[model samples]
Target: MASATFPLLPSAGRRAGLILARRTEPHACRLSPRFSTTPRPPSVPPDVAGRRAFDLRDERGEDNSRAQSMGTLLSHAGLMPHRDGNEPLSPPIELATTYERPPDGNYLLEDGRGGGRVYSRTNNNTREALERAVAEMEVWNPTRRRPKRRVGEDRLSDGSTTPPMADSDTALPPPPALPVCASFSSGMAATSAVLLSLNAPVRVVLPDDIYHGIPTALHSVFRRHGVKWTAVDMTDTDGVKEALSLSVAEVEGTDGDVVLWLETPSNPLCKVTDIRALCELADQVRCGGGSDVDGGGGGSCGVNITTVVDSTWAPPPITQPLLLGADAVLHSATKYLGGHSDVLMGMVSASSATSSGRRLGAALREVQSAAGAVPSPFDAWLVLRGLRTLDVRIRRQCSNASALAEFLSSHPGAGRVHYPGLRSHPGREIAEGQMSGGLYGGMLSFEV
Candidate 1:
């Protein structure tokens, strides 16, 4: 009844990079090995919870504090210790991105049964494995120490990292799983997928000042497709409600299935909405501002509508919409997820309520396959590679942005600078509520 163990993997956390080593033993890997030597903390602190051990760091030469947040064992130090027969998947390379079946007479596209992978897209080992993990562990019941979120990386004093997928601790629970996870060629493709699944001619409620793409796509593309749109001043619920009413009263039917686009610390402006409150309104499909409305509308009034937020702005770790009650979530992976603007990809992380969430996933995948918009395995690989450094990147970006903002604010040349980290920011209060934990984020804009 002994557990399989792994080895110590480490790197300097300058950027996210992983190191993998193979172990051939007398048992020919009869049992899983243990990799991590981090002694379990004698007693984890209440206010302080972070990953601390230096076998590896993402891209940063320092240790990754977030990666350590999940009780993640970076080293495959202990593996399949409780397996019955044996670890079924060997080569872990076969576990790479696909599998193959015997090329028998039974192999036909129409009647393909027991056939191996028809295509990598239909069945990618790495992506599927990741999807499986997402489906199983999408719930957000994070604790001080035993957090549900983990990437299991082993860091060292050098600049190499080991991913948590290398450890069993990375396999998440299943309640978060659904049948679909739609990936897109770019941010536009992902948002387009949302438009396609929703059946156009409907108005999309957006923050008056948000990402330029929404309007660009809405006008050039979506409008051509019969999709109408409106903008909301998301200062408070009531203001959003006024915008919703203006949009709704102009349209027909039982409010219809409208889409609410959320972009907190909105692009350029850095304006934010209390997602928790907004999501509550969205769930009820109501709109109106509460007394919190800045100047548009006062009193306790709010609105609700089908809610979708571009997590790309703040990213997930900084702010999580699914936990707040987002019907569907989208990410322009190109921005932060890709870390480098080089690769272009978008993702729709959906909840179970929206079938388009599922449908969009399938449809997007189909489009990607048909149009060859499918992210190259290499590109996808690179993106996954970048993800390991996300926390470090974001934190660094925040530091850089904050420093820049401070420099501008104190400058007489600067007219008005809007950054949540700055005390003068109107949305700072709301931003503080969600983006706690000593992280102000990396992208802050200034106005000259």
Candidate 2:
């Protein structure tokens, strides 16, 4: 479990590089369907442009009935642009800090994938690809496996990655909209973007025991900017409801934002917050259904409540907060997503499930560029590499953590072992309900 320290030259371009240090732990750590156990079709020769040498199909020329696993998604993420045999298998690092404008003077990008990249600080292909990969994986459902790609199926056929509309009445409800993602220089930057993106006069509800950095940011930095926050026991549904109610009541008539910041399988303590329950409560307050908090009057349209979950401890295929009704989800890619301790990056994915979520996503994109806290193209590319193996690494980590937790719980010297997988753990049931495949996570803690 050695740690690596590397100079991270951000988009800001500093002569003295900012060092990003990461501990590449076994606990913290994908492949394509083409290499699956299922039989594969014979490979075809590459075309002139060197693309689509072979189709991803079985011997019968039938698409695999299995839904594309998370592992495959991670391994193949950010590889769309390279699907052609002509391009490099790995994502290319676009080193240019700026792109030339078209001769016609129009800055719009026709690809729609890389929106008008006039400057690297605001936009870069490397960073945007990672954002799209994260957003797409965040919404993927493992339980309801869709058959592998139909012959002519394209995720962006509708000009977006939304799942195509179902043809029959028996079709499942349309999945939640794919979230919008923004990458940052660090986890704190991502958190700050969400807090800073809010209109002034904001109230942020935080878990009493959570990531120290977030509370630090709010108290020391954001507080001076008219942002208010209260720490509540997130597991206590009533207490959380009260805190949101009171915070909203204080800003009853004003135009502002209330953010419920959650960290699940929370840092050190392994506290699992009921994301869906709290999100429902926040919605009730946002819609002014909490009559006691605001004199039973209609909810203030001026006051907005947003639920953001910092799932740094729980990466995808482990837990998806946005799918659980969160307005957004944040991850410190430097930790688990990067997996190799070589990249320093953060991600903020705003859910498109709600109108408020949509607005938050738009605002966050603006803050990312305006604040200029963008990660370097190299750092972003590193994360893309890390993502390729995330599925296998984390599953193994979770398996290891489960064993460690069991041993600790029975040890004579150990006082307490905290892990969601354990039956004795307070949040075990909730974790089982939310976490995919009953995989609690890699984080565990104990005191002797």
Best-performing candidate as measured by lDDT: 2
Clashes of 1: 74
TM-score for predicted model 2 compared with the true structure: 0.79
Model 1, 1-448: lDDT tens digits are: 3333444334542122222324444223322223334566577442222334333353355423333331132112112333532343321222344444446644355555453565666555545433332332233334422323344553533445545633234433433445355666788888887766653346788888888978998998778767788777877688776666666555544423467788876887787678777765554434332322221111123322456778777775577666565666777878877787788887776665443244445554565555544455555554555565666677778888889888999999887887888888887888888875555667777767
After superposition, the stretches of candidate 1 with alpha carbons farther than 4 Å from their true spots are 1-116, 129-141, 144-180, 246-256, 286-304, 353-372
Tell me model 2's lDDT, rounded to 2 decimals: 0.80
Q: For residue 234, what is the lDDT in candidate 2?
A: 97
Model 2 alpha-carbon miss at residue 358, Å:
0.4
- Please, what are the lDDT tens digits per residue for candidate 2 over residues 200-314? 7899899998988888888899888988889999999889989998898887767777888899989889999988888778877767555223221112444688888999999
Each model's Cα RMSD = 15.6, 16.8
TM-score of each: 0.63, 0.79
